[model samples]
Target: MKNCCQAPARRLFAYPPTSKTPTPSADDTVRPQPTPSKQNRGRPHSGRGTKRPAIPALPNFLPKLNPGSQLVMDRIYSQLLLFQLFFTGSVVDTIVKNTNTFARMRSEAGKHFLWLPLKAEELHSYIALVIYMGLLGAKNIIDYWSGKEIYRLPFPKSVMSRSRFQAISWNLHLCDPEDDRENSQKKGTQAYDRLFKIKPLYNDIVSACKTYFHPDRQLAVDKRMVATRARIGIKQYMKDKPTNWGYKLYVLADSACGFTWNFFVYEGKSSLATGKGLSYDSVMQLLDLSLLGKGYQLFMDNFYTSPCLFMDLLAKKTLACGTIRTNRRRDQRGTIRWLRDGKLLFVKWIDTREITVCLTMHMAYDGDAVLRRVNNPEREWERRRIPIPVAVKDYNIYMGGVDLSDALIGYYNVLHKTTKWYKTFFHFVDIVVVNSFILHQHLSKAQNKNPLSQKEFRERLVSELATQSSTSEPSTSAISAGEPCCPEYFGSDAASGRRVCALCKLSGLKVKTPMYCTKCNVPLCLVPSRNCFRKWHTVGHS
Candidate 1:
């Protein structure tokens, strides 16, 4: 709204006018009026050019144009709708109080300053952003504080201006104590002070927002991974080259209502260790716990099941339940009896290294007291082998009768909308789990509904997997003609398949070298050897 054409000067009728108008005696009788000047008629009657008023300029300036400025508002508005419906907006208020509320982050986590200038709040940008995004209803930063959106959000335009973007991107509050602060003192220097200095009065004022509105009760561990090429290619195992693809971040959020307990970012190989492996070391590391004990219930799939792994979990006091390897291939001489149909039956297999193990825990439960009952009086819980869907169950054997697979369950479920879309399955599962926890803690909880304890939760989960098959009609075809034989949740690129070690394929090649088997950490050689590795690698073979 600029006035491109300056208005023509007005002929005023006030004292000492730029142009003179008829002036009558102070107490004279009314006289005939003359034609009025068009401009002077509506113009304020003032001393005219004799005393001009000063106009001040407004101060938001930006050299770069924000591309998303146009859609920001609509995006925010729509996203806000979804966020409001799902999450209780208290996390936003909690985020605003990070430093001011926690108080410990500043003391423990924010110990050092960095070469880049910073404030206290910048130290917790990752966590704060999660809380802010989940609670504030902004999908990502592009939609929030946008020039067109947040500028109208009762905040000034400078907050989203292009200059501020560059100014703040450099580790603003990520300061290291021994960092070169003095270097920033001079102009044209990349040092902290000179690189981009805020006026001295406002310096060091960077800290957690003093005005955060929510308390701990309303807060949750919020997380968001901004797409990045590196993380996408590596963390999520998206094999596509990083020529242009951005990353995807998986976050654990508590928008439902709880404190943020843990959060992390994996640049590429998605949750291989944490989500799939259920590795004690991985879980402990992910939770940032030191010697938090090894025993804990690890809920996961077959990719994580192993006797050694099971023992590890038990050592840590963790109960692991999922599918287990029956090892029926080899007819060992030893007889292993399993409790079946309330009777001990001798099976052909034995507990031996010759037969490998593979299993997954579909659900995990732990508490002060434990109780379980079998639904069928004849079938014992230990012998009742609840099966996953056939498609996913035989995923590894899809190509042939049998092949090694980190999982077979994926093939059993095509994960279509008619079937269970992986996204919906996982999302539904997440909701069920989180909300169940909440229900147990705060909601009206019901004791196990089945008085007879007919079905274990895992069996129930498997039953839910039976598909309507098709959105229109229940059909068995999972992959529509020639569609990649992979689950939607399995990730897009099939090239992310695990790799075979050079030595594993070198029986006919050059000299073999000694290597510690990753799973067992024991010295093992290449040719004709199946060595046990102590530490679990999510990529089993690779």
Candidate 2:
């Protein structure tokens, strides 16, 4: 039997060294003969045909605009409007119902707690308060509601009571509790889903993200860590990531603005693996089939780059470029190797070190150079232009989209310290806010207006969500024909005849005042601390 590796070497050195010597030149200087070495070895012919294959032309990358995206852009003129796209009525109702059901279950199990059914309006306020807390970070959750002048945040207290917020956070559930038994029975089986607890909310959010915007020509795929210390099975630890401990998410984002177009939660071995390895399956899972064959360029890291994967992407009319591992593909030092198979180009180029890149969209080296500071013999650093591969240059430029998204999210992350694993939903809330802000910037540029910063966008969003009225009309009944029908407030001279203010009671405040509305015939507070009378007439009627 012959060694398989020796076949290439035997073919490379098939012609032996010749005994004949070259004649001297006119100056009687004999030219030296070139020697055969690894670096100067002649190019190997492609097995397909005698003619060298031409480099495939780069396809024009024009992303197909999603039809629904235009409708969303037209409808979303405000931060609240964009937010409502993700948190629709059905989404909020699901949260409200599940939270109430969980609280009821806990109450029935002898947990000593008051169980007031959560309303959709109150849930909105709760979410607003949570986002506010993230914006104004604190040392502790109770610090926002602290009585101390330095620690108190009036916005959170004004939105919802601290106790009520705590209650909702503690019992915030995504799925029905009764399904636990049925889920447990399927454990360790093929039907088991580790993410079933938050699957509905997760699916809804993912769908909304894909529906609202079409990504640009350049896109990047990578993984992010949502920091959490919870003792859950799905938690992962990545030493390379800034957040070493948390849930891992495979994300696909737009390279231009860092808009997260899609994401998949990593569930360890139980995740959807297509037998092609985790990295391959993760990229495939995050890619939208509708966006394929439309000339989009994808950039990824060495973890996801492979010959088979790049060829697969090329088959679908999508172009990709990424670094490869030495174990997966061999590299030679101080040499440039170009191997072409069909439309895919496999290049191994030497800069400071050898780098193997598999690409379908870029030439091996297009005379592009990048400036680098080098240490000279005098021990001084000098800027020098070094020739680089086009594929490597592009990979460096557009491969940080996921990292950019992670950085923006880290600015005002809403994920707080909580034992309840469902609280991870707050990470998704932060993602939604980041995506909305990116869209906001694009729309602002299109309309020739200045865009708000992420901080400003979140503040405006919190205000709208916290103060938005649940009902489009007034909760009060129409005034009768015989009623006073006047919409003004009147104060009685007798202060002793004070009654509980109607509007103040609804806002979790108890106040007694002699002021009454003439038309509605309801007692309302008129003091500076509690302006129930003016609020009732303004908000209740209008």
Candidate 3:
């Protein structure tokens, strides 16, 4: 023990103290501070161990949508055509098949179920009735079919029988039973699919949404809750949301017209964890890469705002702006502090309270002022123009896309109470309708025509979908024998070419044919199922 300490003590004492301490000079009393480099001189402290320039003015080159990629008319003039764009024949066919299969399965299981095989036309009528129900809300589902004078609705009774509507509602399925059973048996990562029951329908709808319309420059990402009290594992409780207890869905929508471009159901902790953070991954997942790199501007809130995500989006040529959490990075020591790193701008501004925002598209400052009414010392309200950052102004303007969508959906929400969780598909139906309505507005504006209100649009849509066939006898004067209109071959061959039937188009049916009226010079279907030629002649077209 003595030997172990002796060597260390000798080394420590090797340097002897000076005999007399040197006297301190005035010059040595205080160390000279080094001069700041040009890069950092006069820069304000950003409270994060770095100095940054004062908030700069708004940049000139704000991202604008490419001219060629501007919104063009989809050429879908009818409400039915726009609706069919999202709910295609394939989607309808799948629903019909799965619904029939599920009904048959129930019958085989000895359940007291009377189910006729579902047809595509009948299913369309059923959906139309559902939309109608949303418009005329009743206390109970049976009220729409009730014989009582106050409860009776002619539309529902005419479109579908009460028994048939109940049958479809009870057994409607979106995925095949066999496939779902097989998938359930899978272990580990594959076994637990929260949306397994409705995955097929969900995929088709999402794919169609992306394919049909490209979003404009300003887009927003937010979460929406589908109100439900069903005892399902995926149900979430968001206290701040109006529909507080329900299934949560993250939606990316157009800020201009509230068009839902893409959405996904929020599963749970296990499914959402992606090594990054939940907020970061959720935003990344909802965004389509094809839509990026095209001068698109994305807006979000504190939930999804992070330096990493904004940088990643910038790298792809997509601009983003949103409020951020101070705890996520550094806290601001003073009001209106900002930091600029390359193209990224971080702003900590105080309005009513503190608000931290991160944006890549806008400059840190622009001489913009927003009017705010404040109570003066006399206890009277007075208006004042407060300076607002450009980022804050734009964020306030464009961050409500999802909220706008929710408001529009709620106005005529088709969702009804149900014990089964899969019935949440009704929410998606409402989403499709809203998207179609938005597209209709855009198309109507482009064509210099007034767009129908949402109520009118849905009414027209329901009527078109509920109509059974185009060949329905037209209520018109009978054709005279002296009329020269007669059916003749119009195309070189039936398989080579065809055109839309004049009569069928008038009846809101998209029927194509190779036969034409000799004198009228318009195509008309001559097939056995659709005798548009004879029907057109019978209708007395000149």
Candidate 4:
């Protein structure tokens, strides 16, 4: 019995040989370990009664963007436009240099040249003049230079001489003669080709807009009238506009800030080949496919809103809200009149405008909830319900972007009759200024900075462009002792190739000098004894 008791004590110290799990002692707590199974490959183990929630499915429509995002788009566009202008200005400067040289050569050959070559500074001043004329509301160029009795201050003559200004304005060429001729030859098929004289500038501006500026969620498309009575082939007439007779411009602008992102002048049947007419082509041109899939919304009037168009936009992942004409919609059925006041109704049907089928969306507001002030019997104004369609309300709210852009342009438009082409050029300048201002406002809001007003911005821009530093003294130590030369001394190389130095020739001396100062870009005597480069640049030369 003593030996059996000793055996039981030995069994307590050793574990039993079985596949079952071991029992825990009273002092220890047992925790369960997860089993390796295919079903639990991706998921981690949770404690008992704890469950993970299923992830929700992505909806068909993207969430509406915040208002701040629109401002960001505007800001980006503005910077791009400015960058394009800088490049354009550089190219123009080079062209002007070459043209001036050519003109001088022609003049020397005793050939009559109509266009006088202009300097970059002069071009800058001309741009400033255009802006100044718009802001001052001057009737003509001469009027601005020549102050009227009512005018307290005249345009400073020192900024740009009137004659020089006129010459530059009249001869402002954005392209070479060869390109203009080539473009003019193809003008019959392309209405835009008629604007080939300034087509390069136009293309640059358009490219800048496309690269940098994107419209906000809500975009508006409409026709704008650039006021002018000039007889041009491309000019269009819109009877409804205040300026009924002017160029018809199809504008794509942001609904929030009225910033014009892209535009094209409506020329005629050729431009309207898209079958949807002026409205459709304009919208297609303005629409960026990259922006479409991001849930952008387009707002247009009856002219652009068609059943097929709406479906096309929706298919591309864009939402459109607009007013539609009865003929524009293909569906004739379910066109019910809202007898029940103040209710919004939707009608959906298959659109069969063309041979192919399309999707159609229609919404109507009974106008019962619309209110207007009324004069009561007590002779006091009171709010009263006025029925207006919901479509009308939405249209009125979003359709004003084009109107706003027009207003901004009209407030200080810079177009006049020098030539029809000049009118286009000035119009472009107006666009650049307005777009720049929009960008300025956007940046200010983004950075929490104070923005300059449009007027202030223009003034600063004009000052920077117009001011050229001609007084950068020559670094040559040899020319420090000479008398200051006349302004005419620094003029463009003379037409007469056989000419002598003005100083040397005036002294009744006949001396030839091949050495021309690269800095001054003028011919001067660089003889061992008589160095006119030193004399010309110096202040006390004979």
Candidate 5:
């Protein structure tokens, strides 16, 4: 009551400036900066500061991918695959730099070694993948990446240096040990074969496919006998090694994704074509954990339908389904006595404008019970010599064996023989999936079985994270431990629509910082509640 009349005068004057910098915001915050000229204004300005427009909306993004290249002819070809091929093309460019040593690549293969540096400071294999990516484009991969940051690295230059040949030899050692570790030979005889299992570029292709595909669905093994158009070196058969005039490509792949996992290219003459077998060790090496599951199925053409191998797959609690070549007689074959399951396995005779296909149902042994007994030495001691004709030839001489009912097999077989014919089928499938997506997109149009919408899937993933965030252990190297673990790159986290971290709900706008977590090497924002900082994503960070 005493100061009421004079209070206005007391509040009239304000205090002076405090400090130059403002206090830090929450750790999760990345507060926006002011306009360029207004950033450090000394006092209020009526016309001194430059005005700026509001920030624009960001674009949308999605993460995760499929596998394969060539746009996938049906299930066999896919976008993920094409993307990978684009990557592999980069790796191939690395190897192509030294192609002068390999006679097979002697002819100028268009812009020979176009993107490769005449000299590099790092191992060719050590070059950042991004560089190769830029080098390999639908039209010109090198020209595309020339202006990118990755090309500026000194590693590329070091790798191309003559002194770094040791590294090239070392890489080849990982793929094949046959190469000379510390020697240089004339152009015609250079040990390019020892440097890499596949042509360098091809390995890049393989790597590219793997990044996009989900996992190895089923493993397929097949033998390709390719007669050369030149005076090729002699080699043993596909399996047994001695010497021959032709070469064979033993390819192993993920049945579900059609990504080539392992391929062995061997050269031999016909006289040396005696007995050769595929490399079991190589096949095992190429197996990707993504493809391995608690339960899995394997497929093979006639070449790998060995009785011993069959028993092994069953022992591993996995199923091995393949065509049984008519030529190979089973040791002990009596089918009617015991059979477990039967299904229609499609058979394709040819690949052309019009494809010829048929479905066949074959009886398969149900080794589910006492699977051990199938390979029990005690049970099979007498079965080895017994003649079993359980396996028979298909109508077409080119194909024979147990006709697997899987339509995927038929599609893969046709696609593998030649890719052009299968693409049409793939496009048709894409349309069907797209239409299905559209139907799911409109909730009202959905049938009793509602398909998940993009929003729904995102919500589900978020919910799953919430539950996982609580139960996950505090330590023990769980990816989700530190910051929300890692945010999906190119997914909603990085998408343009909103600057919110899909994971923590923190506005990326506030925490403009992009600090990376030391443990996981991921952007710190990905950490869910920093389950490491627990609640920190909310406001705990001091």
Candidate 6:
């Protein structure tokens, strides 16, 4: 009699047991095997040519784009959709308007040393700055903005002034005037909220992620540590991680494509907890409620896997597979039997190298077994005789999706080394960029075009987002051109107050003067040897 639920172990090494002692000794514990039912014997076996079930092909999750479109073009169009859904025009407008208000208030309050007003163009430039820094991999903000070693392929000289970039970096605010906790005395309200300032933007990013793409049948839940040494309350330390100190995020992503569908930031002790424990709560938080009852298989690691969690997921019609720790299993005795590495029975194969146990609501007989090679120091390596369970193999295959998402984020991470706690908010922006890139790749593939690589993707994305001049108001040079004498000269006036002189600014000269031509309305210095007014309105400086 054999246990129908467990597989019979197969022989490896092509040799009989060295000693002919009955495998189970008098003192050794033995599992109780059930009588084999006639129906169970009638089913197909796992041996060669045993008529195994065919694996169903995975469905394409990419939506169809217009035919004959180039990948970069499609990517640009797809980015527009992503921005609209996630970082909408209204959202940008609110940020810009509120930022301007905050800047004015700061200047009025004498907190700002320089009168740096936040403008729409600078906001665009700020986004571009983050992208440029991510792509270039600079040591610091200074190194990224310096022109000494610019990468010619993507970065051009003087794309933006370093001082202006620095100013924007210092003044970037995601919250509105009302939400700014500058003077709030509510102790408990602000104490635990790590992301209180940028909560709105964070919520919008999450909402956009949920709305933009639908995940595949298989999903993975895992934790990621965003590297930072900042003194924030939400900072977590995982000594095993390459980045040991940082903020932790629980991400739910598509297994096959690594598209992040939903995510939850792990705050301190007050956060939600499942009936089973913290790990269960994390899995539940990341998994969207609407995805239930869809037969989606969720893959996790030992930290979150337990028989109770599996049963809960099974009750919701969602299947789960993971490497479970010994103590977490409900059938501790049955699970321990599979932990020993060797042959179990004549028909069923068990190898402890791959899996301890694979749990499914129904029999996991739909997928095929996976081949694994075993290495021996004394002899040539050979494939293990016993095959790995399909559920176990699928769990191994899809388990890295969240890690893969983290890897992509690392290539162009927006979070930099900073003392400020709010830099964590910028990490979410990096997620948006990575998610948008994923959407672009899928949409491009649907159009049968080769998608842009991550490097090229960021280059194009930054250029597109930053190229637009602000239309809401005139630039600082125009206002600082100091009152155009006539309406005809308004076109030539420099709106940017930061502009010293058109030639001086372009020539990288340090000269500064406020004089301008009354008719042409162009800013130029009137120094004894360097009168630039005539050259400003003329055909050529020469």
Per-residue lDDT value at 85 in model 6: 58
- Candidate 3 clashes: the total is 0
- Cα deviation at 255, candidate 6, in Å, is 0.7
Candidates 1 and 4 compared: the better one by lDDT is 4
Off by over 4 Å in 3: 1-76, 187-189, 270-273, 327-335, 341-343, 377-380, 469-542
TM-score of 3: 0.72
The Cα error of candidate 2 at residue 355, in Å, is 3.8
TM-score of each: 0.26, 0.75, 0.72, 0.62, 0.31, 0.68
Give the CA lDDT, 0 to 100, for residue 414 in model 1: 16
State the lDDT of candidate 6 residue by residue for 188-272, as single tens digits. Answer: 5635465666766778888778767777667889888877787777799998889898878889987777777788777776544
Per-residue lDDT of 206-236 in model 1, one digit per residue for the tens?
1111111111111111122222333212323
Looking at model 3, residue 46 earns an lDDT score of 28
Model 4 ranges off by over 4 Å = 1-87, 94-116, 147-155, 186-192, 291-293, 326-368, 374-382, 386-390, 468-542
For residues 1-542, could you state the per-residue lDDT of candidate 4 as single tens digits? 22210101110010111111233233322222222333233322212211211212221444333333244433443332352342366665755764465455545554322233466656666676777777777675666555357653444455665545654554566776555656777765643366656666777776665444556666788888777778888788778778887777788888888877788776666744667655666677777665434566677866676555665576666666665433323422212121101111122222112111111222322212333454556798655433233444555577788888878788878787776656777777888777777767777777777777777777666655555423211133443245533223223554334335534643456665544544333456665788765665664222
Better of 2 and 3 by TM-score: 2
Task: Kindly list the per-residue Cα lDDT of model 5 for residues 1-542, writing each as its tens digit.
Answer: 22211111111111111111233223422222233343333322212222211212221211123322222223322322222233333444444344323311221321111111222213223222222222222233232223357544433232232222222332221121123223324224533342233344445444543443333334566554332224334322434422232344555554433334444454322232323334333334344434444244455554454444444444444445544333212222221111111122221111111111211212211111110112333454221111111112222321211121122223211111112211222222222222222223332222234446533432332233223222211222334444553323423444432232222322223442233333333233434544422333333221
Whole-structure CA lDDT of model 3: 0.70
Q: In what order do the candidates fall by TM-score, top score first?
A: 2, 3, 6, 4, 5, 1
Q: State the displacement of the C-alpha of residue 261, model 3, in Å, after optimal TM-score superposition.
A: 0.6
Model 4: lowest-lDDT 10 consecutive positions: 5-14
Better of 1 and 2 by TM-score: 2
Model 2: pairs clashing at backbone N, Cα or C within 3 Å: none
* lDDT score, candidate 5: 0.30
What would the C-alpha RMSD of candidate 1 be, to one decimal place?
38.7
- What CA RMSD would you report for each candidate? 38.7, 11.5, 18.3, 24.1, 38.1, 10.9
